[model samples]
Target: MSTIEKALAKQKTKAPATNDVVTEEKNTESNESVSVNPAPAPTEKFDIFIDNEKLTERGFLHTGGNTTNQQEEFRHIKRKLINNAFGPASKTLNNSNLIMVSSANPNEGKTFVSINLALSIALEQDKTVLLIDADVLRPSIHRELEFENSTGLLDYLCGDTDDVSQIIYSTNLNNLKIMPAGKAHHLTNELLASDRMATLSKELSSRYPDRLVIFDCPPLLGVTETPVLASLVGQAAVVVEESKTKLETIKRATSSLNEDLAIGFVLNKTIKTSKDVYGYYGYGYGRKR
Candidate 1:
């Protein structure tokens, strides 16, 4: 063969090899473009605005309450409950972080204590608080907090919504969260006693070791669900109204609670004079054998 013919043939073969290399690079770029994904959207907040000024005016604890003696009183009260939940006492108790605040009868300030206690705990450096208004029959968390009522615990228990995140709401009060009692239902008491509620309780207690979950429950005397709920929590704070709560009634109410629970009696409305702080006085209770 001639030299020119040999050079042309060699050049033609090299051109095809170069084209094949360019084609392979183009294919790689196309696959990468198809695989690349867009960034995700930010999640919206499920939130509630707690009225701190109203809460403070009503003699409750919160950031707005400032350095009042009432704050000092609750600090003393929550200190023991904190010890029971996260301190040394937590070792011996099942789900010590789960606490229930209830009363012998209605209108005894259980909800007041529940909100204040939640506010008190939310102030902790390392702890968070979720307040669940479990009193479905007569929901008050919304009324007291001055927020419009909405679906929550009942909606979840009724299978209206399966997601727990949908029910729990963040508050403006920093580290404090809440789940309202939700719209009242006919089978409310039955729902509280269901196996699903039990499972939910297990998840709430076990999921967060640094979070304290408080349930503002119905009165023990008239309600059947309180005892079922009492069985779930490790601690109970029974509010007894000063002068109005009869001794025998207190006996009957306390008798219904589970013995294994670490119980505490909160003396409510102890204000003898206008000058007094007139806050709750909590005393520990132990079952008598």
Candidate 2:
């Protein structure tokens, strides 16, 4: 079973913990029903085409395919994420709508999860999701979605672009927009850690209260910027490659994150059983230290 499912089962059989999932969407049971035909939230900018077929062939969640196991699996995970963003968890964390998805190390399926999660959130009846490729050191969202390498997050961060809207593009996928990592620069660390980033984070949070921002960050262990970026977002989903991600490395990676951040671990590439997908997510309250 997925961690969320396991946690729900545990809740049914035992006392609830501070980390249990809260706030089921009132329109429908969040973990059970997938909302269809979400009205597209319009945005002004270049039009981008997301190749659903290409993404399906890549084993990512099929946004266009409504009945697939991939879609259902992500639907379950995104509910918990959305709950933490807009539900009771929002009051506790800063910029609770902004979620950062990273990994202990590279090649652990963080980008894959980030994309699928965004797509799944776009399926929501009353929510929109913005997927930002913040892995400036090694960007992947554009390539994975088959969009042209375009100017994006780094361009704005480095003052190459005066407007953030120019970097965020509207996709054919309803209610989902994207911001690519833009051109890489030697000053990437400085640009990402600068004060301008803080201002942008606030704008993103307050400007769209119903939108969830997903930052696809670089792996946490080796990259200095990931931790720095982590501080800017309220929630962090650390993608842990099953069997390969060591216990010490996962703890070390998360230790660098801010104490106020709502942290969660996503177990990726597991042997899929009848009751679960290849990934599982279990979120918890942040440590006070």
Candidate 3:
């Protein structure tokens, strides 16, 4: 069996019987049947063509086929995040599983890092990943993954839908699921700070404590929603383009975040030189409180 097929078979074997699945009534006017503690259900899975050619052109990890140095870099980066999530370091944090990937400014490669990190984490034997497009103002996770656009975080927060399971999509990767940004809204910032959004965030972390929920948030400097979203996550990674991003910019971006959130810095697009052993790019863990 292929990797995807093997994953599907494993899911089927682990799934509870239909009658044993938990179901709850929708509190809203809509009568949708929502699963209270929806374990990764055996649902129809969609295929995402990682397209190594396209990914390499964009300077992303070529996860579609053969292993590359880029993939190895992310594996190393994810290991630290995973360690921080469940290791002894995580004992003090409440929602260490929720992570937000952001940048100092636009085009700093935060989205690329977010997707790559999610992909890397999904490869874990005992971990599943949920990549959320929290960059609602300019959503890109669905587009980057080449998945069809569907209702997502905003829809759940707007009261248009109460059942979040309806918007969450399972991918052929089995361990990776996606939550698109949903339709754009003028009051995006307000919606993100809503009570429902807070509830949803808590639900996502608590329902699947084993799952790593990664949010592709907007640039920290200019975006209003990013700071709000960052507050909800236990950890945040700020992607800084090597030589291009200014120290002042990084300072300004990081200042908006909560003092308690564990922050990390990822130096992306560094020039590859013969002197270095790891090719290009570097990462550093920021202050963790």
Candidate 4:
């Protein structure tokens, strides 16, 4: 069983700590008839087309998708940084649809941040969010959300599937959907840069004006894909590991982006205390250090 199904099954027996999947069956025993409720199987299963080869399996995105609390923390940072970076770029830019979560290199929490951001937006009572795993070369959102990777953005882009919506997996998060990346293609770069991607973006944006689309892209320095993706996303956020990201590397990454793309930096794994929350700088809380 997929992680979501497992979680749902657990939820059926108890309150889920995060997303809840509830199933109810009504039954009546009579001399001549019996009644019961039907349970629909949760979404599970996936496939991949690698170098013109096809493969299939259960979902991956929802498998280990981040929880709601982690999402909330990301939301806090996203809200704060948008005000700091994009606020002045364009008053209307705050109303952007595309958001790219990236970093100088790998292992800096970019994927975690991006997925959580999408989850955060989806959790919003008034918003609809779609988290697209655009990192085709090494896509992880599929695994995170316990989503089946059989057919997805790559499938749609390659014309393997005509109905793009078929691959969109509805999640426990209300109003939230996911479009994961499929197998690596021979022309991955061309597909990402194609007009088809732009058209898909436009349609998705137009359909859900209040929707937020978060693209979990590859590390800017490690792959050409990120800069290419940056060209498409309206804004980008960089997650810097505390005491690790070099200022020079950050500059190089930022320099590659178009100035029109709003850039914001977040210090992750930051050390803080209660005083820090009370207008006091540094790691101390209310107590003086």
Best by TM-score, which number?
2
- The lDDT of model 2 is 0.76
In candidate 4, residue 118 scores what lDDT? Answer: 62
Tell me how candidate 4 scores on lDDT: 0.58
**Per-model lDDT:** 0.75, 0.76, 0.74, 0.58
TM-score of each: 0.80, 0.81, 0.79, 0.68
Q: Model 2, 145-242: lDDT tens per residue?
A: 87776788888888887755567776766577888999888988899889988888887887777899999999988879998898899998888887
**lDDT of predicted model 3:** 0.74
Backbone collisions counted per model: 0, 0, 0, 27
Among the numbered candidates, top lDDT falls to 2
lDDT by residue (172-258, candidate 1, tens digit) is: 554677888887789987899898888888877876777899999999987788998888899999998998999888888989877
What's the TM for model 2? 0.81
Candidate 3 residue lDDT tens string, 54-148:
65666655434445667667877888888888888788666888999999899988898998888777666578888999999999988886767
Can you tell me which runs of candidate 4 are displaced by over 4 Å? 1-72, 80-95, 271-289
Candidates 1 and 3 compared: the better one by TM-score is 1
Give me candidate 4's TM-score against the actual structure. 0.68
